[model samples]
Target: MIDKVIITGVSGFVGQNISRYLSECSFDTEMVSLRNSDWKSNLDGIAILHLAGKAHDTKNVSEGSEYFKVNTELTKELFNYFLESNIRDFFYFSSVKAVADEVPEVLFEAVLGNPKSPYGKSKLQGEEYILSKQIPQGKRFFIIRPCMIHGPGNKGNLNLLYNLVNKRIPYPLSAFCNERSFLGIDNLNFLIKEMLQNKNIPSGVYNFSDDEFLSTNELVQIISLVLDRKNNSIAVPKSIINGIAKIGDFVKLPLNSETVQKLTENYRVSNQKIKAAIGIKKLPYTAQQGLEKTIKSFIK
Candidate 1:
């Protein structure tokens, strides 16, 4: 029975979602900011969720050093404190990008590749530091590498897609086929609750995602189904789309090459390890159900 927890980065999306979820589950949570120096004094809890880290800059405007300063350095600092404290479990929220930006196949816990971006590199450094240390007998450490996490509060590519569908704009990249995995916020909270109470689950690196993978076209269809709107996907030629993306590179347009690739990329992540460890055959919500719930939230 886990009573209390200390969480950092409560201001972020995942932090806010998890904080509220845990509170609803009757667990007392203490929100702390890593920017403060006295956070060490507030570690009177069963676990510490280190969620404070710089997010990926899609515009490529952020400095490379900024990634290290927050994701790598702060992680090392807080982890050092955890090493000396009575906190029983340490959960570090990492990204699948920490392993590879481009997944040629399905990603698992053991896949190792060079992370192209600074954000990926910094997160990998944090994971390496936590694993390099020898944990105390009673303390457990979890490194969670979640793929694209989406829920009610999230505003990202999904929101854009929903808006486009609402406006009756046709999806032009239906020609490209891709399989991407998504992690629902509810599913994530459920897994965390399991980890908190079940000490039998061993501590290690786990890939966090929904049980199934969905493609962008399928996502568009799901959005349409949720909105009660007709699917407006048009199979535009790949060559023409690539040419338009090339033109978009120099102009201020929505469909850039990067954006197109992000929409149509095969980045499937496996949650088999986590499910097996938690003794669950499936997650609480299916991929379509979770996505539809999120779409409904957008309407609200």
Candidate 2:
């Protein structure tokens, strides 16, 4: 029964897709980009989805402070403003890294948070700011912690893998066995829609991901199929890949240390909380299906 929705970071990948999805669902939507809009007016009778934040840039360590400034400080400013406004519901997008850099054997709601990077610390700070506020009557807050999200128009490391597979490039990390969960943009859209309408969902932190997980080799296989190419995978030793990454780092090549870690690391996030909240056992799309759809979009 939500009437109007306000989405921040409208120009970014997730923001754009979420905004478009909401519009198609017949909700009155207002798009707001941090660079273009001023939030002086009180937003009465509306739900606000805040997605604007400094994203992680693996190549540049100097930008870490900026991430804290925007993700933490800007979030504090916005929360203060919301306290004065009449907005009924607020949704904040955070990352799984805020909780842990490497997924442990078990990831639960009570796990200790020890963020390794400034980006993770900033997002954790934002979540803390919201939770510290005194709950007001008729107002609800949601802090969503999503794992690596992929879909059409995604520009993260997932895209690099897709492009490499599309060009029939041989993947050298086939020997490394790693499992990771990826969130599909479409499933996220569906979850948001449910959150806006369902009054029974309690205000709290929630984790989101595809119901199933996939290993790196399986992911590459999906990409190869989408590109209509025979899978070109090599079982290179992990030590050799690490040595090449070190060399690449010294030479300032595209495949640096960070990229190497990302390709071989296993970061599996749990989505049990989100499923319980939405009363669903599975998401709308499977991990492989969603990944194939994303890879196909890169072909054009």
| lDDT per residue (tens digit) for residues 178-245 in model 1 | 99999889999999999998999888999999999899999999999989999999999999999999
Report the lDDT of model 2 for residue 93. Answer: 91
Each prediction's TM-score against the native? Answer: 0.97, 0.94
Q: Identify the leading candidate in terms of lDDT.
A: 1
Query: Whole-model Cα lDDT per candidate?
Result: 0.92, 0.84
Task: Highest TM-score: give the candidate number.
Answer: 1
lDDT (Cα, tens digit) per residue for candidate 2, span 226-290: 78889999998888888888999899877778887788788887888878988988889988888
Q: What is the lDDT of residue 95 in candidate 2?
A: 83
Collision count for each candidate, in order: 0, 0
